[model samples]
Target: MNVSQPGLSRSIALLEREVGAKVLERGRQGAQLNAMGTALIFHAEALEAILERAREDTLLRSLGLEGSVKLGVTPITAAGIVPRALEILVKAAPKIHVSVTEGLDSEIAEMLRRGHVDLVVSRIGGGSGYQELAEEELFRSDWGLITRPDHPIARRASVRLSDLRDVRWVLPAGGSAFRQQMERVFASSNLGWPTQSINTNSILAIKAIVMSTDCVSLMARELVGVEVAARRLCIIALKGVENQRPVGVMWRRNETLSPVAARVLEILRRISKDELAVRKRVELPKKGGRSVV
Candidate 1:
């Protein structure tokens, strides 16, 4: 990028010759990348990522470090699952350092494709580009109505999406894929969305508000394992509401993970089995029923 005019011209000439097309659309103002240029840059960035991982490995080896991982997660997983996994991961391989980043589906999915993050742990079916990545399903959790234990809906012996229609809602930030998915449940049932709602991306905020008020929200059950255990919140458990929104480990197809990332992936899978077992021990809510955390 810091090349002289002559050097830059030479590099562009070489690239155009190799690709058999002009990589740039030159104009009097300067130049802009063509389709070929954009595609080449994407692959070039991926190549840089592969080399960067190799470089990290080399440096770690010389310095006698166990290595580190950059792990991407969604908010739901960050709530309980990832922390639980890390508890085991740290004890299992204490030397391996894991740097965790929590983001919305749109953000993390792109990071996975660009190799900005070594691996992404999230629910399947984000949208168009998500299906291109390979998946290793870890665990499945249900989505449903969540409310405080003393709330009126919590007292109902039988409930439906109709019951949630008029209630105040604690919704995710507007326009997030997660928020869209939540809104779809109501739309699918002709219930429409709640006109009265609180929007936030924080799992803690959702839990706090749901536990103290009648504002119901939808989320994966696994996200609130702790509050469920302590009886701080309860599920409105819907029947036949379509579960599997299963969370799993995702990475670019045909990509090889670095030693550190691979180790973390192994621990995530190992811990997920215990998560799979929790489906049998809900104590609070029934499985085979719709749930939200």
Candidate 2:
């Protein structure tokens, strides 16, 4: 009558029929599942394990996280966050293997469109024809002016575009939103940003150049904070700039995610608070952003 007790009732029924003997002397003192009943229990235990494996395999394949997932990201990922996220995921699911690659935002986006990369982490621009790609805003950063400690303008707590009128600049490549923002700030001040520059996304390379020259670069405050604290570089707040730059997650809209990719995205959505705090100390927004995983 009680099918719920798999260990007792089921085993008793199974063993009694198999052995043609009263394996369990039920309704007696201390009577329990007998040797034959116990043997049946062990067999059922093994059978459960087999069924569980089948179920897990089916789920893993359906999610696309089992075999492999390829990702393309910008230089920042190579520096820390993505790699660290993968490290945590590997510890949790030892069998899942993930491959990560790095490239410029445009290049990564191309790879995703061509079915080359499963996911991409980069700046979203234009959004011209990415109907197949879905974007999820991950975090945002503020742009600040960075220069060597001894640079003439380094003494200022903050700087307006007018203050930087004659200062030489190192900027991102022509199409970057940051560069556009800088140009707009300069234009609003009735001045022009020096076009002679080193254009790069390599933070360390840019830092090295800034530390060695009188040139200034605009970047996330957290990116140069370490050098600032060490007096190798200094941060001058931008007085007339919009501080929000949204970083996002991108993946194919219609395609299914692999099991490993799904798990990686899970770890990535948690990336803002747990991962960013260690790398840049930036505040990750809660509540509004949608998570793919």
Candidate 3:
């Protein structure tokens, strides 16, 4: 990289002028890239990789895999599965660099549509608005009620929707699919919704609130598996509250994926299959049964 302070300043000014937005933030410490600058850098890097591939196609082919992959992932998939898959990918193909964007399902799908990301790993369903995107089912996840390990309700043999009607709850945003499913379950059981509720989309914040307070929340079992295994969280076994969602990979419909992206997708598929097999072999506790590690 070459350095020219005056030229760099002029270039930055021109970019800001053309985009009608400030791309950088200047402060006491130093200049830093703002959101717009960060986005520009991401696209610039992708373009650079594309140019490099064009110049060294034969070399890259000989090397097998060498490029960048931009991935959009939902919070749960990012927390539970993506890291492990990335670790395996790095060991298998060190030259295939991966960049991940973690967000809600809708946000990631929009990113995919806008070409901000190469592919997305998220819960797929009808009316998702990305029907034109190609999808490959990876696995399925079921939702369950979760709370702190030592919460008073954690010791119950069985729980009911009516029993939870008055308890404090950490809920997803209103009108979201997860929230709607929970509400349907409560309604079907003839139970009123909780009056005391904290609505958020951040899985980490929800987990923190549940762990430190008495608030209970619904979450995918695999997403909270590590905490449950460590006895930090407990899943309430309530009958007739089954809610399963399909987890999958989504990409642009008519476009071919970059080699690195394709390889990463392959790794994710393999990991998903392995995880599903493991879950099947591990006997799950029955409804009204105590927590099992």
lDDT of 1 by residue, 1-293 (tens): 67899998998999899889999998998899999999899889978977886787678667766887887898777876678878877887787767888887768878878777888888875544555588788887778567787777775544777756678989888867677777777777777677799989777898899988878888776776677667687776676466746788888777677776777788888788875686578755443332323
Winner on TM-score between 2 and 3 is: 3
lDDT of each: 0.76, 0.69, 0.79
| Runs with alpha carbons beyond 4 Å of true place in candidate 1 | 27-30, 130-132, 277-293
lDDT of 2 by residue, 201-291 (tens): 5667788999999999877754665576576877766777765446667887877776677877878789876645664664332221210
Whose TM-score is greatest here? 1
Structural similarity to truth (TM-score) of each candidate: 0.86, 0.62, 0.72
Question: In what order do the candidates fall by lDDT, top score first?
Answer: 3, 1, 2
Clashes of each: 6, 7, 0
Report the C-alpha displacement of residue 230, candidate 3, in angstroms: 2.1
The residue ranges of model 3 lying beyond 4 angstroms of the native Cα positions read: 1-65, 175-177, 285-289
